[model samples]
Target: MASKTLSNSLVRHLMKRGYAQAAPARSETIQTSVLPNKTFIAGVDTNSPVARVTVAFRAGSRYEPQTELGVSHVLRSAAGLTTGCASSFIIARKLAQIGASVSASGDREFVYYTLEATQDNLQDAVEILASLISRQEFRPWELSDNVPRLKYELAALYPQVRAVDLLHKAAYRRGLGNSLFISPKRIGKISSESLQHFAGANLTAARCAVVVVGDNQDKAALVANCLQLTGLGEESKAEGSKYYGGELRKEMGGDLAHVAIALQGAPASSPASLALAVAAKALGNGPVTKWGADNSVLAKAIGNIGPFAAAGFNVSYSDSGLFGAVLSVPKDEANCAVKAVAGVLKKGGLSADAIRAGKNQLKLQILSEAEAGTSLAESVAAQGLTTGNVLPPATLAAAVEQINESTVNQALASAAQSKISMGAAGNLAFVPYVDEV
Candidate 1:
């Protein structure tokens, strides 16, 4: 049995290494700052002339109060409405005419407004973003026009997206989850007056970050223009709390089965975070680790003889972080799947080869993101928010190099002791019967 396991592990390792060898290497420079929360990153792709610009802010859903749940999202939508140079509609239309794309999103931790345009249109794009960030008029008619549309979209997304949102809600506390875009009732309650107040209070120059990725040799002038437009002074302070204090819970219901689990993981700065990520990949990744196989202990014991449409785990980090798995299984096999997952957690059977493969895969995935201008900007922005600096490739390389069998085992042990919060989203009901996994 030992020899067989070792042979299987070796085969998997070689297969994964083959995939890694084929991934292209990416090069980029990431510049970071704290006082102004600015990031200037450039992805050097010789073939593409397209550049991506992003103006990100700390003012995401987490800043929203219970009464103002969906207001941040609404603010993101209205950011470009009527700036000094152009109205939001005209700006969007002009960008489209120039083959540029502009969009925005509000997450639990931040709000990101992005613009992608060709190198020729870089300056115009930056001006457009700067105006949207600093000079948005929030016209009454624009708000009136957009509020209902946003509400309608939110209403439409609720039933379909409820499972993931509920998982976040159960994992993070009520306020944080609501901040992360689960605000059906709050969406209905927001008024244009309240949205204006929220935007004015939160979307200040001090809270914003500008990340430009392209061959814009005139970066200094762009930065100066952004500073002048924002009127950001040294005295201005960004407002918001970074810590989320909460417990994880599992909620089960309906015909479709959803299993969401969360445990307190390492801070973004910890070297062990990479290991924790590798462990998650080992236990949950199907194409990479064979952890989702039907004959595997988890599947066999669950009596789940067929393939799972989706089965994976996610690791989320802020000041504090959570790592957990969510699986979709048939109603009849739900209990078994849960027990099997719990069994793996208890046994801590994560292999060395699996850890190495996961690290390689994750590294490659990060590289792919770097190949895209917008993704690269978001990557740096997220890392800056979490660690107060860009997590450089050298840092990630060192962390991955240090991960081995012993370290992976240690990470698994840490996760085993972690607070596990589980949730179900689909056709079947899931319940946590016992605590000691």
Candidate 2:
């Protein structure tokens, strides 16, 4: 009797607090603007205490010339090094005073500097970003200091990262094929002058953008602060990238065999790109949990091997893309693992239920990334750089829903017939080549 009375009391308390129904959805609006000089500005208002900002450039490794192979990597490392307006120590001290966090990251096609701090300090953060990118001083001593750091970063590239680099090398041969990291062989060859010239030519208002996500009331101030990006630099001369497939192998000795097999894929602008991503998720993304583990199609196909895992990946560039799987296995079973994966792709059949699950997984992945402040800023910046528009997660979710089993099957078939690029590292005696697979 006493227990029943306590339950009744709790129910009455919840009812008085108005906890009886679900809350309504958010507005989910995304706003955009283009400055007179062509710099793009976009904002996504959210209920986050911390504000996020990104100053991005279209000048990635792909734009580097034949003579200066890794100048882009060097330039990226020089992000916080000294600027004409302030010494490195002053920059660091002022940012720390505001309790701001800063970072730099790049890929083959883009580079960016990101800042995250309390909403109240958003304007200060933007000013610091402007100073860093616009007045960056490319001193020779600083360049020498950063080369060792870059080398250390490259030394830590895992098998997956190395495989992707080799895969791009095999697929494009040049331009996009250029490695994203500094090649140890070409370290001393990259002079400070080349770094300055590259930045002067590519970091123009026309090729750069400022992206922010924070309180709705602060949107006007954010845009005003970013206006500092205008009236600077010259246009970039980015060459078109072409896909030419082949094979590349290295005989580095390691316990496990690392192999990556890729074929031509849909570019970022293609509608089929969403379908391809779903198809990849269905293939495999590693076992979901360690204990019971997942028995997805690709997982079962390679189950006979002693120790192995498969991950489906699709890399989309502005003009070309690569879709394939990277497998790590015991060296002796490498051949068997390769054949099994290829056979599954060649003989494609997926169920409707599987397609539904894969689509949901893809949607969740995209949404989760967007909810994270820094990642959403990067996505907006990349979209603005490429197409001058940003796509909301809901639009991508709807696209994933339209994909069915037949769509995935057709995508798989198209991929299987395209020219193949194979890359392998470690004990390579047993690893299969592209033609053999």
Candidate 3:
């Protein structure tokens, strides 16, 4: 009877902490807490059969020292390669047996690992995560085994990745970009010792956020297990400087013409972030016909190209942030495309329609993600990383509601007046020069 009551408590705790039924009709809620030295957020959707767990550390390439470039990326890959309990291959096989998936990635500001599995395997997945996080043996042999494969994969991806890297390099060449995050030279210099040191320094409980999104009745035990494994320590107080601020540059080259453009934008917490999103969508996103009617200047300029093969904008926020656009076009139309894009940037600020569309799109995107346990987990984890709290649906909805035409226009005007930088990669020889708009 005591065991049954304890079990019931655990189930209740899990439900309170964002675990929910796995079914599509069920609404999901996220639970947040600051436990000892660590902060955690979880979401549980009981109606679905799949569950997701994400753990993030507020450390990434931005935190690496100049001498230890690419260490974060290397460490992320190595985390999956070997933990004390088993080889990465063995873990993968086990996860597959239970219909689970695991992966990790490093970004400019953070490194994250995720696990997706069914309800029955949640405990196993949690244990695996704990082992990887706390008991991983960063053996030399494991690093040696994975380095060649990592290098090969990076080499293969270089051609496609070069343009994106070049853009970031051009925009943020000073601080963060000079670090490993966007520096190709630094990425090539990653070593095993550096990776181990980086992990040890950054992957502390204080710097971590664990998010569990699914329907699970045993959440209290899961939290307790995590706390025991991670051993809550003092919070990390590492501070870093800003990354970008300067004149723009353009590089000309490659078979498919590429243009990368950036302007100073809002911080993640700023209301302007929504405005920027709306502006990006208004210019070049989704089915062009949806927003880009024949009368729209952007549509007229770019011409109806059926579905855009590849075009999107990113509003990257950190200590500093930028609104950036990347477009791929035929060699002959590259200059035209760049100019057209520039014109859009210069003219479009924000509109009621654009704001409405962006809000709807964002809401829809979030809803769609909720259907997938892995995506839901990632969303919750990412929110924890960025805001030091879970993004509540009500808060999100309120923000969306507050994004009116006036607000969007204000954001757009700010974007237009902000400093601009440009980067390009491909076959052209000479960089294109443009006068300030």
| Top model number, TM-score | 2
lDDT of 1 at 59: 72
Q: Which window of ten consecutive residues has the lowest lDDT sum in model 3?
A: 14-23
Q: Evaluate residue 379 in candidate 1 and report its C-alpha lDDT on the 0 to 100 scale.
A: 55
Per-residue lDDT for 417 in model 2? 79
> What would the per-residue lDDT of candidate 3 be over residues 26-113, giving only the tens digit for each residue?
2556556665555554556556677767777767676766666567767776766677789878877877777777788656666778
Higher-lDDT candidate among 1 and 3?
3
lDDT of 2 by residue, 243-331 (tens): 78898887778877777777887777765666777776676566554444646667788875566767666666677777777777788
State which candidate, 1 or 2, has the greater lDDT: 2
TM-score of 2: 0.89
lDDT score at residue 91, model 3, on the 0-100 scale: 77
Q: Which stretches of candidate 2 lie over 4 Å from their true place?
A: 1-27, 215-235
TM-score of each: 0.79, 0.89, 0.81
Clashing pairs in 2: none
Error of 3 at 338 (Å): 1.2
lDDT (Cα, 0-100) at 297 in candidate 3? 33
lDDT of 1 by residue, 1-437 (tens): 00122123322321221111111223544544444333332232334577766666667676776656677777776766887678766987887777887788756666888878897876676677677776666677767777677766665652224544565565565444654553556554667678766666666555555566664324533543464534332331322223233334334455545555555566555666666666665553443333323332333334533444333344444544455555555555556666667666656556666666666766665555556667666555555555555555555655566678888788668766755555455554444443533
